[model samples]
Target: MRLARQRAHALIAKSPADAVRSVFDLMENLPEVERLRPSEVGLVLVRGRVGGEGERFNLGELPVARAALRIPEGPVGVGYVAGRNRDHAELAALADAMVQADVWRDRLEEGVLAPLAAGLAERKADTGRKAAATKVDFFTMVRTRGEK
Candidate 1:
């Protein structure tokens, strides 16, 4: 589920405003979710794990937009997204909330999560391909003199 949340976060953050608006517009039977903590912008101290295994270190502060929403069904979903896009934050919280529900969980996964994750992966692959285009390979060949 963490992956789902991360996927939703990435997708919502990168997607155009119109695309997000369209998703919300076409969404049906969405539970009434009210913001418990209204979307707000703040700075969070970024932490890093060196080499993915070393002790954590405070990297720097990053500006983030966060919101929390409570659905009457059960869970209180929180959205923590990079950048100050309030609408994206709200939509993330909404997706989180939807993912919690039994009825809409699969729908949310299929409709939003899957396609967005694929697009994100595709974008990453394209970036890698573009980068690979300029990559240079270096090799050392053993040379034998007349004695050899």
Candidate 2:
């Protein structure tokens, strides 16, 4: 039997809050908004968090959101968002666009393009330790059964 596969990619800002907010906005204005999911869709609140200043403020808190949407057999889904934390709208939109397979020309403009671009410049100036860890290489040898 042949297998069908769908791929989705979301280039989110370094912040998850931003991702959440954009998703919520899309869900709220589904009808008026361009490149959004339909009304009959549903979404699941996967995760949430709140923190600042190197302190554990709140983690895994299920913030109240507006709606969730899933397209039938379309490999695209969206979640409407709202609440006190109204931050990650742009990231959310980008993520939704990726999952929906709808790539808008203005994705970067509407999403992490500007913020991340500026952030990249700022990071260049700072001498902080690199946030990401480098990969360590490891190799294994396999021997085939042969006349030794």
Candidate 3:
């Protein structure tokens, strides 16, 4: 279920709030969920390293949205997604709680996670191809002094 939660969080961050609605809409049996902490948007400090191993520093502040929900029939779930879309956060937390429930785990992964993963991979590959097109290489050729 931990893997599902991670996938749900990533999908929520990568995809738009509207994307999640279609998945739930397709389901004939939707589980009841309570919003323990209705989705809220706020700012958080994003930390980073200058060169992957340099001193850590506050990169910048980024707007984030988060939600907390509980399945009265199961466990409470929390979701922290990038961007300030309240609906995305809410849906992510709902997915998190649903994944915790055994019956819904596989269905949610297939209906939601799999498609999102595919789209994300596609986007990444496209970006990589574009970057590779402009890639540059440099080499140094040492020349020893010779009499001519």
Q: Judged by TM-score, which candidate is best?
A: 3
**Highest lDDT among the candidates is held by which one?**
3
Q: Which pairs clash in the backbone of model 3?
A: none
TM-score of each candidate structure, all chains considered together: 0.78, 0.29, 0.83
Model 2 misplaced stretches (Cα beyond 4 Å): 1-83, 87-91, 102-111, 114-148
Root-mean-square deviation of every model: 3.2, 13.9, 2.4
Model 2, range 27-80, lDDT digits (tens) per residue? 432322343533332234444334434534434444433323333324333433
Worst 10 residues of 3 by lDDT: 16-25
Error of 3 at 70 (Å): 2.2
Assess each prediction's global lDDT (C-alpha) against the native: 0.78, 0.38, 0.81
Of models 1 and 2, which has the larger TM-score?
Answer: 1
Ranking by lDDT: 3, 1, 2
> Which residues of candidate 1, in runs, are more than 4 Å off?
1-22, 49-57, 146-148
Which TM-score value belongs to model 3? Answer: 0.83
Q: Write the per-residue lDDT of candidate 1 for residues 1-148, one digit (tens) a residue.
A: 6776666666777765556667677767778887896799999998999788989999999988888998888877877778788877788888877777777778887777676667667878999999999999999988788755
Poorest 10 consecutive residues by lDDT, candidate 1: 15-24
